[model samples]
Target: MTEEIKIQAQILTNEVCQFTVDRPILPKRSAFFSQKEDAKGSPLPEALFAIDNVVAVLISGSVVKVTKTNDEQWMPIAKQIGAAIRKQIQSGQPLVAEEDVRRSASEIDLRKKVETILNNEINPLIAQHGGVVSLIDVRGADLYLQLGGGCQGCGMADVTLRQGIEASIRRALPEVEEVLDVTDHAAGTNPFYSPTKK
Candidate 1:
């Protein structure tokens, strides 16, 4: 008998919900399946795409973020997703195939390079403003970052990311097509340029 897999679902947005299982699914690299073809050798994404209304599947750090096609309620869909993920895990299928791992090995190197630039170059520059930047994840040619400290909710955050950070990343790694800021500015505790500041 297959061991029962427990999953917890959390709504991230109106159309996106994150489902986490008790065990680690994908620890190192994240796999994104915007379509069934993208799933390829990954049993998890392929299983997830089989479900109705699951437009995309992103597995990273033991969590699967499922994006629905429309603004449907998450309660009903999340239940189905949770069950599917449980079944998929219990099947003992590989999360990512050996071939796929070899294919994405270069991306790991690229991610490390990006992290080095952030630590050595970008972070120091932002530190002067009482701010810091962190590399969240790298998907394909896109780099996701989170800005913290004084830069979190600052009005100049966008300008800094677009003109300064993005430019710097692009210059360093021309292969990186985009550098996106995933920081939640509204939740920022300390902003360098808050309008309410005296």
Candidate 2:
């Protein structure tokens, strides 16, 4: 018989909960799924999204983060998520479809370079305003990003995206085609400078 999967569940923030499994779930490639469509090929991520209120999922090694609407409590949903993960694991199949997480050498190089700029340059400035910008994925020459913390719902998010975030990335990587924002600003709770409420 296959060993039962054990997962330690914890709340990361009002909107996010984490599940740490006993073994590596996505050993080779990490993934971030913000929409149900994004979970297509990944069985584990797809299972998590089936749970109501699950807005996002981040899979890195043994860690899986599930994000929900701020208004919903984790009390009811946590068990469902845990059950889904365990079920997928116990099914004795690959958690993620290889194609879903595979990256070309060129894509990998670009991703690392983009992350370096986000870490060394962009995030430092955004941090001052209680915000954070993260690269979600790299597809071909385009980048998918999500802004969190204060930048999530800030009135100046667009200005920051166009003038600051995109500008910096474009300057450092002219080959990068599109820098898209996939953040759910409506779910943001404590935007530092929300000129108008979300």
Candidate 3:
């Protein structure tokens, strides 16, 4: 068998950790465990494991990260999970369903709507502060945006994006699922409102 897959696990913080694999697991054929339930009378935490000993599994981009209950040891379970992932990948199963992707992609006409909103609403408001909002791309219902000028490095940018920009876009286009700002807030060299005195 070709060693096309590899798994590595590392503890990030006491509460947060990460496990990464070299190859993509879960082919389209394999079943997706999406049902989330917990025992009655007890309110379950977000990371609580409903499937046997395994807790929560999240697939973001190319990585499959898992979080387990506080009592569980990751070392022993890591190997088992890695083996299962490898088996699923080698079997040629699809990681995510095509129907879901199609459904998500169909929800919103991202480019046109985003451009319209930016042109009409966001730009006019930001222009007052010498800032600009640029639409990067739209994948499914998620929009990628970049903030420049006065808005880029401002400490209040997060607040503006969440409360102002996101709210306005969502109001204009209800089909939009999320607006993500992909700007590198730390590297803003020409922010419109710089603190340094001349």
Q: Per-model C-alpha lDDT, please?
A: 0.81, 0.85, 0.62
Query: TM-scores of all models?
Result: 0.57, 0.70, 0.44
Order of candidate numbers by lDDT, starting with the best: 2, 1, 3
RMSD per model, one decimal: 7.4, 4.7, 11.1
Better of 1 and 3 by TM-score: 1
TM-score of 1: 0.57
Clashing pairs in 3: 27-93, 27-94, 28-93, 28-94, 29-94, 150-192
Winning candidate number (TM-score):
2
Better of 2 and 3 by lDDT: 2
Candidate 3 off by > 4 Å = 1-108, 194-198
lDDT of 2 by residue, 58-137 (tens): 77789988889889889889999988988998888988777766633456678789999999999998999999999877
lDDT at residue 7 of model 3 (Cα atoms): 66
TM-score leaderboard ranking: 2, 1, 3
lDDT of 1 by residue, 32-93 (tens): 55567767777777778888888877777688889887767788888888888887777778
Model 3, 46-102: lDDT tens digits are 222333466544443445556556776667766766666666566564545554334
